[model samples]
Target: MKVHFIAIGGSVMHQLAIALKRKGYIVTGSDDEIFEPARSNLAAEGLLPVADGWFPEKIHKELNSIILGMHAKADNPELLKAKELGLPIYSFPEYIYQESKDKTRVVVGGSHGKTTTTSMIMNVLKSAGKDFDYLVGARLEGFPQSVNITSAPLIVCEGDEYPASTLEKRPKFHFLFPHIAIITGIAWDHINVFPTFDIYLEQFRIFIDKIEPGGVLIYNHTDLVLKQLVEQHPSSVRKIPYGIPQHRIENGITVVTLEGHSGALKVFGEHNLLNLQAAWLACKELGVGPAAFLKGIMAFGGAAKRLELLARNERLNIYRDFAHAPSKVKATMEAVRRQFPDRKLIAVLELHTYSSLNEQFLSEYHGAMDLADKAVVFYSRHALELKRLPPLSPEKVAAGFGKKDLLVLNEKEDLLKWLMEQSYENVNLLLMSSGNYDGLDVAGFANKVS
Candidate 1:
């Protein structure tokens, strides 16, 4: 097969390019801006473009298909040329569906915990020696890439609610008609795209409708909105609801009780426990028993940047997470507090995403950081200008969060200074964001602090 990628420098797009290259498919790609890791990895794989920038002449009739990335605009030159040639163009999700249409697709979807839950299922299946292809959002411990394509009978996908491509405004999950679908939970997000909560929720409804007939839906019953949605929607698929499995924290270790079997887990937090149960149910449908599931999951450390331990000492520990949404921030903060109840937790959040920096959306974070002894919000003025948004004052941020004591910093140096002045003794520091703090080496900073 011959596949050409347009704007393929994205985190997942580059991985998909590599996956296809490894699958022996003639893979070629071009991007105007290629950053680190993607630039290096693609070069190493000999898949990097000869030059940066789109060449409309590169789009030829001989090409089998064009995989478009979200990074490409609608009027992209290469895309225009592909359309002019009458060649088939596919968004990543559409192409994934095309490849796995014959297989039993298990798609894990939700506002939060999708990556972790998808990784858990991948870990269990891989540990059980199951031949399967997967596409997870984050890089896992054992997975060579974020995406794997093969002639396997099963394909597990981390279904995202974000738009699939520049042309496709619908959620990516809507395209994958999963035989087994899981919704970990739902919270309003992507305000830049879905302007209203009702509209955001309607996407999930459409997703449920997209499930194949006689399929199975495993949902988080603990999430009230999800529960109501499932109850209200009459479907042909079988419904199974799961919550946090019986678990207890002992000496900083988390033990989950499954059936009569009990095992310690490397991942903690109520959200993760619920994620585990969701993954367990999906694995059960795929012929993995409770015993095997427990054994496989016992070794699961966690997906990258989802509570990843960066640096730690006897008296201090630092963790980083990809938590930009209000609900996710609250959940992550609560998780750290629960894990180390005795430690004074300091939660630092970076308002980097479009929604997080928006004036209206700022209030959604009210009381989200209440679990932390100290809460701080950081946003760069340059970031606002880049996003084409207006400047936000520190008073506005503090007022939005409804915390008069909230420390809001806009300068990276000032934030660093404040962090350096803090006492790290017996404190748990949680840094949450979908971005780096303006090129701050958080791990190195954590090491210095520790």
Candidate 2:
């Protein structure tokens, strides 16, 4: 099969291209501006475009398919050319569904923890020498690629709720039609796409409806909304709800207890506990026993950037998390506070994504960081400029968050200064952002503070 990619510089898109190439498919791709890792990875695989822009000549009738990345516009030149030639074009999710049509698909979906849960299941499966294809959102420690699709009979996917592509305009998870599915929780997100909380939630409802008949849906029963959704599913579909397992936190470490067996865990927090439970149930449906699941996950550190420990100084610790959503922010803050009750906590977050910077959606973060002794919000004006949104005042951010002393900074220098001046003595600092604080070096800064 010959497959070409438009806007192939995307994180997931480039990985998909490489996966197909490894599958013995003829792969070609183009992007206007390719970044470091994507550019290097594509070049390494000999799949990088000849030039930096679209080439209409590349779109020919002989090509078997064109996979469209979400980064591409609906009227992209390559896309238009492919359409003119009546060539088959598919969004990323659509292509995934096409590949896994014959496999027993397991999709993990939620506003947060989707990547972690998916990676947990993958880690356990790989440890047990299980052969399966997977598409996780983050780079796992042992996984060579974020996506892998081959002749495997089972495929695991981290199902995101974002629109598949500019052309599809459908939530990515809706197309998976998983035989087994998991929802960690539901929190309002993607305000730019869904616009309203109810509209954002309705997508999950559609996802539930898309599950194949006689499939199983595993969810975090702790989440009231997800519990309600599981109850509403058809009788033919089984619902398995899980909550926090028996566990204890000792000296900032969490231990999981299963079937009277206890072991130390690399990952902590109630949210992660629920994530582990959902993963356990999914693994159970796949014929993995409870003991195997517990033993494997004890070594699972985490997916990239989710509560990642960057540096440690005596009694002080600093963490970096890809946590921009309101629900994620709250859970992360609460976790740190609960783990280290005596230590002072400082939470610094960046308003990076479209959903986060949306003025209408700002209120969703109300009291999100209240658990922290100190809360700081940083958003570079350049980011807002690039997003074409109105400049947000610090006052507006403070009001929206409903935290009176919520320090807000628009300049990177000022934010860095504030971080440096903080008393690191017995304080655990959490730096949360979808972006890297406008390219600030996390390790370098953490070292200086330490």
Candidate 3:
């Protein structure tokens, strides 16, 4: 099989290209500019385009399919050429569905925790000697790539609620039609796309409707909105609700309690525990028994950039997370605070995404950072311009978060300088953002502080 990719330098797109290439498919892809990691990884696989930018000449009849990435616009030159030639074209998620149509698809979807939950399932399945293919959003330990395609009978996908591509505005999860699905929880997000809370919510409703008949939905019953949605939905799929399993934190370690069994878990916090329950249910449906699943999960640390530990010392620890949305920011901060109650919590957030930087959406962040003893909000003036968003003043950010003492910084150097001046003793610093602080060396900074 042969496949061509438009705007393949995307995080997921480049990984998919490598996965297909590894599967012995003739994969060719191009992007206007290829960034590091993707550029190097693609080059390593010999799948990197010889030259950057779209080439309409590369769109020919011999290509078996064209996979489009969200990075590409609807009128991308190569995409237009493919449309003109009448070649089979598909958005990333649509193509994933086509490939795994015969398999038992397991999709993990929610506003947050999807990646971690999907990774947990993958970890358990792999450790239990299960043969399966997967497409998780984050790079995980022991996984070669986030996207892996093989002849496995099962395909576990991290089902993102975002639009599939520029041309296909439908949420990506709607295309999976999973036989087994899990919704970790839902909170309002993606303001730039959905615009309103109800519109954003209807997308998940449509996702539940798209599940294959007789499929099982494992949901977080603790989430009131999700609980109501699941109960009211008329879908014929079997519904199983899960909440925070019996667990406790002892000496900074979290222990999960199963029926007649208990074990320490590498991850902590209410959100992660809830994610664990969701993953456990999904794995159970896939034929992994409780004992094996528990044993397998003990080794699971976490997915990249989701409460990832960057540096630690005797008295201080630093964590970085992909948490830009209001709910995620609150949950992440609360988690760290709960784990290290005695420590002085210093939380830093970057308003990098369109939703977080938008002046109108700022109020959604109210009380999100209240858990921290010292809260700092950072936004790059250049980033605001890049998103074409209106200017946000520190006063507006403070009011939005409902934290009177919120310290807001616009320059990376100034933020770093201020952080360096603070003593790290008995401090648990949590850095939260969907993007790095304007390309700040977060790990280096953490190491220096530690």
Candidate 4:
């Protein structure tokens, strides 16, 4: 099959292009601008566009398919030309569904924990000698590509609620009709697309309904909101409720003892434990038994940035996480504090996303950082301007977080200065954000923890 890509510079899009190329398909692509890693990766595969601009001539009737990336707009010249030629065009998720429709689909979804949980399931399945295709949001250990397509009978996906593309306004998860689905937990996020909490929640409801009939819906029973939602939604899919696995923290390690299969896990946190239970249930449905699953999962370190330890010492350790939403921030911080109750937590959060910077949605962060002994919130004015959002004041941010003593700084230099003055004796530094605190020097401060 010969395929062409429209706006192929996206993180996952470029990766998908590479996968198709390695699959022996004739692949070609173009983008308005290609960034560093994507550019390098695409060039390595000889799939990078000859130019950075769209070339309408690339669209032809001979092409079997045109995979569209979210970066491409509806009126893109290449897209229009493809329509003119009556060629097949598909959004990333739509194309993924087309490829895996015959396979047994297992999708993990939630506002948080989805990536880690999906990674766990993939690791267990792989170690169990099962052949499967996968699409995860983050780079995982032992997995070279986040997107892999093959003739594997089973496919595991980290379902995302974001819009599939400009052409397909529905959530990306809606396209993957899973035979077995898992929703870790639902929390309001992506305020720009979903204006209210209820609206944001409706997406997951649609996702649950999209599961194939006679499929299984595994949900987090501990999340009261999700529990009620799953119970209220009547469907033919079998309902399986799961909670945190039986686990304990010993010497900063989380040990799980389930059905006599006992071992210490490389990843920690109540959230991760809950994720582990979800992964266990999904793997069971996929034919992996408890003993086998435990043996495989015990070696799972974590996804790229989900509570990754950046720097460590005897008395202090610094952890970086891709957690920006209120629920994620709270859970991540609470996990660190619980793991090292004797140590002081110097937590820093960056208000980087459009939702986090918006005054209307800022109140959702109330008490999110309260678990920390020293809490700090940072945001960039340039980011706000780029998003065309209203200017947010420091007082407003403090009130929104419900912590008057919260050290809110917009300037990266100020944040760096304050962090440098902190006492790191017996402390755990937890830095949380989808962005890197406007490029603050986290390593510089982490190096001083010793």
Candidate 5:
């Protein structure tokens, strides 16, 4: 089959294009601009577009389909050409559904932990010798690509609640119609899309409703809101609730106990523990026993950037996480505090995403970094200008976060200077953002500090 990708420079979209290329499909893509990694990755695959912008001539009636990336606007010229030709056009998730319609679909969805949970299930299934195709949001150990399409009987997906595409205003997860689904928890995010808490919530309701009849839903019971939602949603889908499993921290290592057996883990944190449980239950439904699950999980370091350890030593440690939302910030802070109770923790967060930087949505971060001995918030002034958002004052950020002494920095240089001056003696530093601190060398800094 032939497929074309619009907005091919998107992180996931580019990966999907490569996967389809490997699947013996003729894949072509165009994007207005391409950045590092995606540009280099496509070039390596020989799928890089000859030009930088859209070419309407790239679309034809003979093309099997067009996969629309969320980065593409509704009026994208290549997209318009596909429509004009009456060719099949699909959002990534919609196209995923079309491919996996005959397979047993397992989708992991939440405002947080979806990537980690989905990766864990994928790892465990592979260890159990189960054949499956998968789509996760992060680059992970043991997986070269974030997406893979194969002739496997089952497909596991990281189900995002974000709009599927500019054309399809529905959440991406709604298109999967999973036979087995997992919802880690929900918190308000993407204010640009949903605009309200209730509106944001109704997306998950639609996701739950879309589950194939007789399917199973594994959800976080500790999240009372999610628990209530599950109870209220009347459906034929079987309900299975999971919590943080039996686990303990021994000498900086986390060990999870299952069925009277224990295994030490490379990954730590209670949020990770909850993620592990959801993964275990999902793997169980797929016929993986606890023993096999433990074997696979023990080898799973983590999904990239979700609590990824950058540098460590007997005295100091540093981590980088893709945590920008309020729930994510709070959970990540609490996890670090729990694991290293005696360590002096310094949490530095970069407000990069629209919700994180917005003056209104900032209130949701109240007490998010309260567990840290020192809290620092960073945002690039250039990022604000690019987004066309009004400039935010440190005072407003401090007020919104409800922290009297919150140190807010608007420049990467100031952040770097502040970090360099910190006493790393027995300290654990957590750097959280959805973006690199405006292209700062986070790993180099981590190494120097360590």
Candidate 6:
């Protein structure tokens, strides 16, 4: 197969390119800008473009398909050329569906926990000697690629509700046609795209409708919204609901308790316990029994940046997490507070994404950081400039969060100064952001406090 990808420097796009290359397809791709990690990863796979930027001539009659990335515009030069040539074109999700049509597709969807849940299933399956293909959003410990489209009969995916591409305006999850689906929970998000809470939630409704007939839909019954949605769709699908598994935290380690058996786990927190339960149900559907799933997940540490430990000592620990949305903030803060109840919790988060920086969306964070003993919000003026949004004042941010004691910082140097001055005795520092503290070395910065 001959395939060309537009805006191929994207995190998922580059991985898809490498996966296709591994599948013995003749793959070529282009991007206007290629950033690190994606650039280096593509180069390592020998899939990076010979040169950056689109080449109109690359879209020729011999090209079998063109896969579009969300980064590309509708009138992108290569996209226009491909359309002019009358060749078959697909968005990322459309192409993924094309490859997995014959397989039993299991999609994990929700506002959060999808990546962790998908990783859990992958780990259990891998350890149980099950052959399956997968496309998880985060880079997992055992998986070589974030996406793998192979000949395996079962395929597990972390289904995101974001748009597929400029050409395909539908949510990516709509195209997956899942034979089994899981919705972790629903919280208002993506203000830039969906605009309203109802509109943002309606996407998941559409996703449930798109599942194949007789497919199973597993969900967190603890979430009222998810429970209501599943109840409304009673006959169309079989519903499986799970909550936090029986577990205990002993001396800072979490252990799962099952019937007549108990096993220690590397990952913890209420959110992860819920994630593990959801994953366990999905794995059971795939024929992995409870015993094997527990054994495998016991070895599963965590996916990247979800409460990732950066530096730790006997009394103090520093961790980084990819938590930007309001839901993510609540879960992440709660996790840290619950894990170390006796320690003084200092939480730092960055408002880097368009949604988080918006004044209208700021109120969603009300009480989200209440669990922290000290809460700090950091954002860069340059990031606001690059995103073409208005500069957010510290007063406005503090007021928006409704946290009178919240400290907000805009300058990186000042934040670093504050960090250096802090004492690390009997405290846990949780640095949470989708973007790194504007390129500050978190480990190096954490070490200074230790």
Clashes of each: 0, 0, 0, 0, 0, 0
Candidate 5 residue spans exceeding 4 A from truth: none
| TM-scores, one per candidate | 0.99, 0.98, 0.98, 0.98, 0.98, 0.98
Clash tally for model 1: 0
Per-residue lDDT for 1-450 in model 1, tens only?
999999889999999999988889999989999998899999999999999999998899999999999999999999999999999999999999998999999999999999999999999999899999999988788888899998899999999999999999889999999999999999999899999999999998999999999999999999999999999998878999999899889999999999889999999999999999999999999999999999999999999999999999999989999999998998898888999999999999999999999999988989998888988999998889989999898998898888757899988888888999999889999999898888777877988887
Tell me the lDDT of candidate 1. 0.93
The RMSD of every model to the true structure, in order and in angstroms, is: 0.9, 1.2, 1.0, 1.1, 1.1, 1.2
What TM-score would you give candidate 5 relative to the actual structure? 0.98
Task: Please report how far candidate 6 places residue 392 from its true position, in Å.
Answer: 1.8
Candidate 4 residue 408 Cα shift, in angstroms, is 0.4
Q: Model 4: residues >4 Å from true position, as ranges?
A: 448-450
What is residue 109's positional error in candidate 3, in angstroms? 0.6
| Poorest stretch of ten by lDDT in candidate 5 | 397-406
| Steric clash pairs (candidate 4) | none
lDDT of 6 by residue, 363-447 (tens): 8998888888888999999889988998788888898888768999998888888888778889999999998778888878877
lDDT of each structure?
0.93, 0.90, 0.92, 0.91, 0.92, 0.89
For model 2, state the Cα shift of residue 181 in Å: 0.6
Error of 4 at 311 (Å): 0.6
The Cα error of candidate 6 at residue 242, in Å, is 1.3
Tens digits of per-residue lDDT for model 5 on 1-450? Answer: 999999999999999899889989999999999998999999999999998999999999889999999889978889888888899989999999998999999999999999999999999988889999999999988889999898899999999998899999889999999999999999999998889999999998889999999999999999998999999998878999999899888998999999887999999999999999999999989888889999999999999998888999888889889999999999999889989999999999999988888898988988888888899999998889878899899988988888757899987889999999999899999999998788889988888878
Residue ranges of candidate 6 with Cα displaced over 4 Å: none
- By summed lDDT, the worst window of 10 consecutive residues in model 2 runs over 229-238
**Model 4 Cα lDDT, one tens digit per residue, 244-291:** 888888888889987878989888889999999999999999889999
TM-score quality measure for candidate 3: 0.98
TM-score of 1: 0.99
- Segments in model 3 whose C-alpha atoms lie over 4 Å from true places: none
Q: Which ranges of candidate 1 are over 4 A from the true structure?
A: none
